[model samples]
Target: MTSSDTSVGPSSDLSQNAENFNWLLSRFAGNTAGVRDAIAVSSDGLMIAQCIEGERADVDRLSAIVAGMTSLAGGVAGSYRLGTLNKVIVDMADGYLLISAIGCGSVMGVIASKQANLGQVAYEMTLFANRAGAALTPELIRELKNHIQV
Candidate 1:
């Protein structure tokens, strides 16, 4: 995916931590031109927040897909005696899909156009995912428990 020229401001949530998440998303989006959408979702495929353009994609479905892919990759790695899953990239005709593990059970996903640079996108995603893991882990666990209870 090519780099995007657009820039988005940070989200105005009362929590400073949330604002940090927004900043990460904004920075990631701004740096990638082919990045049509990006989102932070729990490992169980629940969306925490998203920055999207044009028609709204089904975030839940996307998250679930990424989570499954991540799990599958992990399983494959395990069979080979590999430790953990780092990232998975799905190349399509029109664009590329990237997913990286954030923490214990969370993943960050990005959808970018075919012209986007995979190497740069991967690097930025790794950085963003690391920060997001630190910022989102507690909230995500609480939210996940609530969903489970419900």
Candidate 2:
């Protein structure tokens, strides 16, 4: 099977207690020009948080897609002896999807509109990812889960 078809592991049974994750995402999305949405997922592909409007089904599907893409990217990097992969960016005709590693076992995905400022958005995403990673510990996970509905 392709790397994208495979899952890595199980998500934490526990959830996060912090409600600020949404606020953080909102600030990120709102501050950036042409940001379509932003999502946070566990390393194993579970939807943790997002800054978008949709039903659970849509959010879950997007989470899975992000997780799958992340897995495939890491696998590809490893195969080429690229050491540890930091992020993955897929540029499309209509928009862009950028994924970056968070903490030890999570990912942050950002979707940008076609008119988005790629450079600034990318830089901000890096900073956002770093902050996310810093907050991905057990305690923070609980906060994240509590704050996000998905």
Per-residue error (Å), model 2, residue 21? 2.8
RMSD of each: 4.9, 8.2
TM-score of candidate 2 versus the correct structure, residues matched by position? 0.79
* lDDT scores of the candidates, listed in order: 0.69, 0.70
Off by over 4 Å in 2: 1-17, 146-150
Clashes in predicted model 1: 7
C-alpha TM-score for every candidate: 0.76, 0.79
Residue range 87-147, candidate 2, lDDT tens digits: 7889999999888786767888888889988888888888777666676676676556554
lDDT of 1 by residue, 38-128 (tens): 8666666666665655423465566667767777887899899988778889999999989888776777788888989899889888888
